[model samples]
Target chain A: MAKKSFFKRITLWRYLFLTLCFIVVIGNPFTNYYWDINFIQGWFQSIGIGNLWVVSPLEGLESILTAKFFYMPSLVGMVIPVTLAFLMGRVFCSWMCPIEFLSLLTDKILGFIPKWGKDLKYRKDLVRFAKYTLWFALVAELMITMIIGYPMFVWWSPPGLVGRETMFYVFYKHITIEAVIVVVVLLMNLITRRMFCRYFCPLGALLALIGKKRQLVIEYNASKCVGCKICDKRCPMGIKPSVGESQTVYCWNCAECVDACPTSALKFVWRDRGFITLPKGTKGESAV
Target chain B: MKRERKTDRREFLKVTLGAFMGGALFSSCSLSDLKNPKTMVKSPIKTNILRPPGAVSEEHFAQKCIRCGRCGEVCPYHCIKYFDVKTGGVFSGTPYIDVMEKPCYLCMKCVYVCPTGSLVPCAKEEVRMGVAVINRQICVSWQQDKTGLMCKTCFNVCPFSGVAIKIDHDFRPYIVEEYCTGCGICAYSCIADTYPENNGKKAIVIQPIKWKKIKEIKLEDIKKS
Candidate 1:
């Protein structure tokens, strides 16, 4: 429960994760070495072993499970992020999402101006709802495509659109409709607060649902609570850990609450099982 | 708290417009390379036995490839890769077969497990997809007074077991048109040619194309061979 450095801490992890993401997005040696082989692609194509359900093809692993009923392996990318979400509740948004970092940096930059200049608006609820709606549509479209043997969602995933279109424009000087979609999505992120993640990302929601009951979660100790409400203010997702249960689906386990707690009342514990309360004679007890 | 209301309105407009744009403006630009003849290469086999046509391409391949380390997974010869999506779109989120270190041996496993038809069946037959064409002029066997040892590199690198291409007594390399599956192993493993200007590698770059039958070699042609 010892006080943690603010900008020094979060920015470190953020920068590291963003750099990896950049490498993934741009052609780096890692992807070329690990991702290109047929066996690995085949393994990924397989469903039970971890076929990303979102936008990957239904041919290899999907073919066996659904008999080619539904396929889209790009969803496999969600495995790590979704798994992290379950353990730490949307940690991907906080720790490793390139898009989230982009928006956060933009928001900070925008903060420099006063009045309307810095006070940009975000459509978290409605646009964020779009991510869920898009998820629903993706599922519905996937189901239909499975039965009909057509690729509905895969044809137009935003990730695919941006990846293909932007590269095409840059490399070949040609812009397709997919490239336009990438632009629109970026503009949306620019205006809103992580709109793609809040509304459009089905994988995020799936992980969030699982994370609500994860074994490890953030805990608020009422005994140490001064009720200063600093933790509430520090939460990026607008979650209130002080008033109620800390097991909310939006909690990303960023440890921001732990860092923000002036009295060191907040702790991230594995379940309610391990109780590592503030060290007896340290600063937290002194504050108490 | 004071800025929350206007923030909410602005948020709404942006999300609504974004979703609308994502849906309305979306198109598959990944397939642009297929349209260009310069990037297109013809396949060897006429009757493709793999995934149905219209199913395999850069865009379709991108969605289907799970970014798994598999194709790279089973390669005794590590030549495949899951391309990144953000970089130049050439191989985004798809498996790109690298023949630089070692070329493919006409093994169709890549096509078989593609989960999607990114690498189609008859990939071997689709010599247009990944065939090895030689730069004969740069080939040591074809030119230069250096020891012929460097010349047979293409013939030595060929994995079709000498059926596709052969080494002449003079150490000249000749491709057997009928036997060559166009796997590109020969071109990829060729030690004689090193040209950086043309994609920083040797070998003729083949692209996947629609399959068609290759004409039969005549007996007189065999005598010439």
Candidate 2:
């Protein structure tokens, strides 16, 4: 009998965590309705228990920009998420975001269809440019929020829409047009896997910037690697993990690549090893 | 590769410059211009639709609110509801109370739960959600002799009772606009709407006060109240 790898164990826990986050996001309204248990309230935009709050950093930043005033409670609410990003390198993208959970499900469902299942191929430079577009979108979103005097992203944020739609369904018995936005984004996963997380999500962009120097990171072992590129194929973020592309801030610490590495060359280590320097003879392909 | 890089850089520069120019144009148009009453883009305020207690001015509420839905979640009476995307553009997902369906009980739980100060915490008495206006024409008590019906449902159900509502010499209900909190309990309990003869019309209805119209409602007053 073969033993299970540590990465598999982490991936299993990630799935469980993601499922739990989905339930918490969508089930709060039902629990509030049926059992009257509302100790925990809110969704991805801002969730809290009692007085302790965990607000989205991007939303908090927008609030600060649009309101044009320093609000103490909201500022305090941002501390937890910002600190988590600092330590964990945007783990929330994989482990907590309900939209990411739905995206993963869409990926799985798409896998059954032969033609649609394959990952979309793009030029190496184009992929890098696409990654850079996340930053561009983030800046554009924030500036728009400031100019418009409202947090525009919150209006159509996938996870927020899911949470609100769930609440609306539970209470009002009708779904709004926001649900269509969520459905469209989820359906787009068929063409490009996790497109929103990779190049469009402003929250993910903000987290990537904050978690750029995160403590926990995927470390590559050159000696153990077989140059099989399975990890590259497994990465949802479209980065090659075996050659230390996982070290990029875009890597959400999902450990999908780690789990896919048959030789156990890639593992999450709690140390900031910085960027990897390529070996003497090996070419660094798609290093970004 | 060198030529491709040059074009890419040029494309990036063009995009960034365009975005900067657009942003500068928008910023040049002052906030006051956007907020001007003459602007048709302003969200139309409805009469019976009231913001939850302690809500800031409508202009600031949409800007400050992150739409966490905590206000609706914490509402004990479940009267607070969100505006959907179709009905609400900037106002979508923000909390509102439709008094005719279920009126605010003034638990003030929603105010405390709001992470942003879109709904500031305040005393129940100081909450000016709107003012209740009594329609004497349909009121049962006002037309007791003619209709042979004497009902004081609004007076009995009012949270402020005597202070917010008072009886005239003829025992007809009269709303004291100064003291009315506009919680809409009176409108919700009004018997005039229940009577088939009155054609389902509420005698006492809440007329929402525009946040801009109330010049004295400072943040300090909200806190102190």
Candidate 3:
């Protein structure tokens, strides 16, 4: 057995990334309050860097749907995030989302409860069905946003609410009723694992769709795999990296499965392979 | 296995159908009212509540704003505040100025940071956040005969002192509405309202101008300036 170097651990790097993201989103107000430095402004929904902009693709879509016209500035703002998704395959979910950080924390807390923690896990197939159903619900939410003539999710979006409430608390010294939605979502994590990110987040769904053919993906070398299923158990998104299912769009590129692989068989690779490509010697059929 | 697969498929269909039904029912109830231009035409103009400078019409502002809170973040004076669900409905998360609390300083950083152009970039002199109107009944300077105090707090704080607000020979202040950009500094610094007898009423207040009024005024000003 060999000791893994600290830098080799993906989990440490991910936590660091999440922490930096939290500071960027929540610390903007503190900087404004104390030093009056506003080089970077805004929350998860939209961030303005100097004169450039990076807006959430879901919000951009909603704005276009409601306004019924293509706004050039918003279109320009969408380019950065859309390009990131095209290259990284929903890295924002694992790397930058504050809600995902909270979800990971909740999972750790739930792990401490005796007996009930094990029972809370759902069957894999049931979870898959629920994810698909919620993806459809995201579509319905966009339709409602169009019908209502406003971005409906802005009211309850967990990541946006986290930033909004933090700003309110910093500026006005009192958070409003909107912070309650974030609390409710965090509480809902008790019943389901990463419930909002896995099932309900429109931004995640949008990123998933945009990054469906992402260049960065998990590659499985079948010859080296021992089939110990450690990667399966360690996957936060319930993806099977051992079976090459980590190539799916829902894979957050968090590399938990790759980190958990005991045989060092699973690895992240930059390639154009479609979803679920089995190695040449494997008897399992490859699916696109 | 075959029976389980069939049931799963049936359940999926049932859920999808239920979602569509829910969306249809919800939209049917509120779609017409939201679509009506007449309802949207009535701007969200409340006393002393001004939108940040260069804000588009209130109707379009709600639709275009993504609620990024960038405007509030870049505001130098920290005068811009967001409305939560408790404070507003469609306007929730939008940036607004409560003139009585903290007034806009006309730095115009919020306009530049707005991604969707909800707050359009404009010159400081071209701002039309609102118009300042003096309440003669409450103004100490206006009632110089009775009070004889000659308090010039508002006149002293006006950004465009000589152009927007002017004092007469008796040191009584009057608002020149044409030149007033309605940045609200005058109302924020008014001493008349701070007096215990005034019961927190502002002597000089920024009355928010609707988009229709701005369009009429700006069209002529654009021709001149």
Candidate 4:
């Protein structure tokens, strides 16, 4: 049989979406000219989708820590994405995060380079719980340091670094140390798939916490089981989605597993019941 | 019993990992920078740089601004620039207006777009950006009237003429602190600005000081011939 077209599938919409957002972010009409040289960064700063962030949750948490409730617009920014995370799972990780997109692309590109290999192989359990630990500690630090007036994690956020660098490099043709650091992190994906994201992204950790109770999620059916382990290998975060069906938040819902499932047993359950087979007619369809 | 022991070990590991990452992040950024990078050694030429109009005190502004760059987008004159990492990691993302490159035109849009109160929202008339001070020594208007070097660039461009800035009987320009909003329009529009001796500096320049520092300009401060 002919191989399935990755671009002709539902998951491709996400790649298309992130690519468009990348364009809008880089095309931000922000800065005024300095010496007729346009030094641009963060023009669509308010245009949330372009950067996939209006403001970070850490910014809101900082305001809450400082007790500036009446005027905290950052809290409002936080609410929108968290609400969306509740609606779906960690769709931010797969669909919208530029760093995630860059890392995934790096993983693909590195496949082409001869002799390039993933050097550090971590135990799966440690990687699974790593993000949660990061989220908790960053929040803990934010609460402790709020009195001193610092937005702590905003200093080296992956999303902000990607957004800011793209804008600067595309428009101003400038690259600073912060931009270089993000690129270095991107380059590390050549050594380990989604390395920075899997290990250290606090924003993803926060969203995953919010998305743990997500109503729309993947349902595993034993009736159609062949135990092929295709979906097991497909998960980007290395979560054994075939085994840990209950661990919904860790799943990016990229539908590569559903695409990879030979029996087509894996399907998205919305307002789910126990065993709703793919509605008879649409046996092999997944649209998100 | 085995399950309970495993859970305890996992909990211990999680907390240790959490504290380590947390401590590493916190100390590595601001704390470590203090000792190693010295990123926040204070911009030695701090005051001369113009901030967005209605901007709070520099110290508070630096702390308050999350540096999203919203002000730069809505700026009709597009005057705001985010200070990059070159400006110390602390000040890197804050918006600043470089007067020599692009001065604030008193659009007051930036103040409106500022998500935080880093740039306070105030009317154009109320925006005291910085005081436009004149150097009488090099001002052509201050030179010999008989030498035919008298200029009216400052007077013609003053947003609030006859009040904020005034041309005296002798044609020398004087600033009135009470009425001057420090919009920097007069300074931006100064034609008598020249190079070589002044190195292309404006004859009239806006000094980036808070309005509270202007000290009720005593009438005797200005020398009238």
Candidate 5:
């Protein structure tokens, strides 16, 4: 058999994504030279701010920390990420999330240690509730902190860990009490893959819900599935599309399922369905 | 398509009202006063090798800052903090350089790092923060030399070197008054602040005291203890 073309075998976007991950997190040492420059730092800051715009839903659920939340210098917080989530379903998590990329690398490393590695499998549906529960507790802590005049979540966030290390120790020669909390969180993460992200990231839960909306999802052609289970087996988040009518809440709209289909049957279709002409034999039974 | 338009005119008005009230309530605090303190004062000019310290009034600082943690991040020294205030209104979630633990050595990291002009840059001779008035009655060196070796802790800690503070031959430390940058290092690192609780051995309140642009204190006020 003739060798498959590289384009037909591996996704170009995945490589770009990996490249972006390396540049943002691992390549920070090089990027740190320009960390203070307006353009470079502002890019990340703007993305963070972009999520703050449609944050009304997240904010309405209030905790103390978020209650004090105000739009910063730019309105980027509320505008960009929300618009993207509405359009492409949490692409930030898949392409740009440092934590997610790190977790994947960690999972690969863990795979070398015999039986201990086998348990480190990704399951989308099983851990979908983790984000929601984490959201609830985060909001509750915000409320409690507000009444008590203390911000409890600051010491437990991933960004907080990195920040405390950079600011308190690196710059000031001071070790914050939050260092202990960061160690404990990291230890827990070592035991469970993406334990903090799956179960405790309020921001992740908010994005996941936005992705879960019916219009903004990956639709599967159940009739064309043919029980190959290739898509299910290849899914990073362990979603089983062969058994379901819809994608899981945590789906990142990565189009992996489309890539995995043996028959050229999978395609992204909008629910609006504006005059898509189908073949005659195929009655108007829309794909899931 | 028109039906999905969830927000209408009335809803827009409500949001506007909420924002206006929130902004108004927030601006009416110390932050606003710091920015536009109903008064402005002139400082005596002096030549110096180091860059002079200048700051935007507190109100202006509070309003302009977005608290994105940029200045704090960019600081080579990381001496700034975003004070989590319950009552300071606009500045409640804002950042301020704590000049006590580490004075702004006039490195200008904070001024440049501040994406917004909350911490604006200044010329060498033009910068003037509030002056430190020595409370003679409460000062250990002045009060019968109670805990004194004629302590000059504040004089030694000032980032401006001997320009902001002076120690006489008798070792009595005095605020130079004119050169005082009001960076608050003396207040923060005051050995007295670290005394009292442990049989007079503790550091107490090192508050980032809010200053008015034209505020003044008489010597009698300092002597009142």
Candidate 6:
């Protein structure tokens, strides 16, 4: 059987997707002319690529909640992201989140960090999945603050803060505290992988809650498996995607582990129709 | 592979319960708490801040605006500037026009471009962004060689000249607040441009304010009369 090259790996594809998203974010400002076109707002808003639209559900929620009056058009803008989550889980985190993009960049620059420390102290655990609780807290906070008639500043959110700063830094030549906070976020990731996306991104938390039950999930075939734990080592988000225990809610489907699996037991199985795996031609040879 | 967390789901659930309990206790506060004129916690909207035309009232506008920077991008005059920390407090990054620098030309593009109704959509004449107040002391017309004969140049510059602004018997420009859409063209076109003696000031200034109801939209004007 022919082996997949390193560049063609799933993680690499995810990185490529991230790169495409990055281009759109910075390139959007230049594209907006008078009224003909607009790029996505930023990390806090949509993720448009080429002519395709990828909306931000969180923006819609914030506008509706904080404004206390719903605008039909803005509410309609949210359908794409919500539908994507319903279908593919929170792939936005793995595929296109700017924070995830920043985390990967910083990880590469500080490449000497001993491969995410395999020690049990650094191993994936229940606490790592505690981001759901953080998500709950933010939504709860939003409700309380809205009830108080002074919605907490959504601009102060990590994505909003960073997105604004990125605009100014790239186009306006000024660095506000928002930009400074983004740098601080990057530095924090040195201590762990994607600390902001894992625990702080309210939007991500919102997506995780919505996309938890997506049928397009990572499934494990334990029968043909060796418990080598290589998947755990390769996971950037620290997700465990084996033994029916994958945190599909948090998995971006970056597919790093699928590439890393020596047994080749790991493959995307479309659960909608009983276990349809990819690379159909290769799957037959690998199974034999 | 590691010892269990010191703070477990039990602690998490306990906090969640506390939040709901606190919420219940607080929601009991009367509706009058919201209506009390003497709001103890000084609201941010008390001051009349000019927002882009089509904006909701200051109170609702502040909460609704997502600070997307879209309206600013669409303005031909580049009048809309996002409020940074220096100018905007909690309202930073929302769109506001600096009339003295560059005023809205009644392009109506910004109102159209607003993704959220942070800037509402309205006809050019219906837009009541703010009112342009002409300062007699600084006005060149009033100061022209100390002659009581005012230049009335402001009337020539006013977009809604005959209606929004007019000259009284004394030839002094008085803004008929009812017609003034506060497009800031008078300030932008002020003959009394900033001179060193004035310490960089114009004869007219657009003060951000919310006042009396704007007359109903003239639908006839919506189409060519």
Top model number, DockQ: 2
Task: Name the runs in model 3 displaced over 4 angstroms.
Answer: A1-6, A50-52, A68-71, A109-129, A273-288, B1-45, B149-152, B167-172, B194-198, B212-225
Q: TM-score of model 4, chain A?
A: 0.74
In candidate 3, position A157 carries an lDDT of: 79
lDDT tens digits by residue: candidate 6, A212-285: 77756666778767888778776777667665456457676667777777777677655543234546555433
DockQ of each: 0.10, 0.53, 0.53, 0.18, 0.07, 0.27
| lDDT, residue A63, model 3 | 74
Q: Over 4 Å off in model 2, which ranges?
A: A1-3, A6-8, A110-129, A272-288, B1-40, B143-145, B194-199, B212-225
TM-score of each: 0.50, 0.83, 0.81, 0.74, 0.56, 0.79
- Stretches off by above 4 angstroms in model 5 are A1-22, A25-39, A42-74, A112-142, A149-155, A163-195, A211-216, A233-238, A244-248, A254-288, B1-68, B76-78, B81-101, B106-181, B185-207, B210-225
Worst 10 residues of 6 chain A by lDDT: A117-126
Question: What are the clashing pairs of model 6?
Answer: B54-B120
Query: How many clashes (backbone atoms < 3 Å, residues ≥3 apart in a chain or on different chains) does model 3 have?
Result: 0
| Model 3 docking grade | medium
Best by lDDT: 2
Writing each residue's lDDT as its tens digit, candidate 1 over A245-280 gives 466666666665676787767776665323334454
Which candidate number maximizes TM-score?
Answer: 2
Which rank order by lDDT, best down to worst? 2, 3, 6, 4, 5, 1
Pairwise DockQ winner, candidates 2 and 4: 2
Instruction: Please report how far candidate 2 places residue A124 from its true position, in Å.
Output: 14
Which wins on lDDT, candidate 1 or candidate 5?
5
Better of 2 and 3 by DockQ: 2
What's the best-to-worst order under DockQ? Answer: 2, 3, 6, 4, 1, 5
> Candidate 3: how close is chain B to the reference, as a TM-score?
0.76
Give the per-residue lDDT of model 1 (tens digit) for B74-183.
Answer: 44445543333232132233445544544566555544444433445553434433334556655656665643444566666665545567766776667655655545
Off by over 4 Å in 4: A1-8, A30-45, A48-54, A63-69, A72-74, A111-131, A140-148, A169-173, A245-248, A271-288, B1-45, B143-148, B189-195, B199-202, B210-225
What DockQ number belongs to candidate 3? 0.53
Residue B170 of model 5, lDDT score: 71
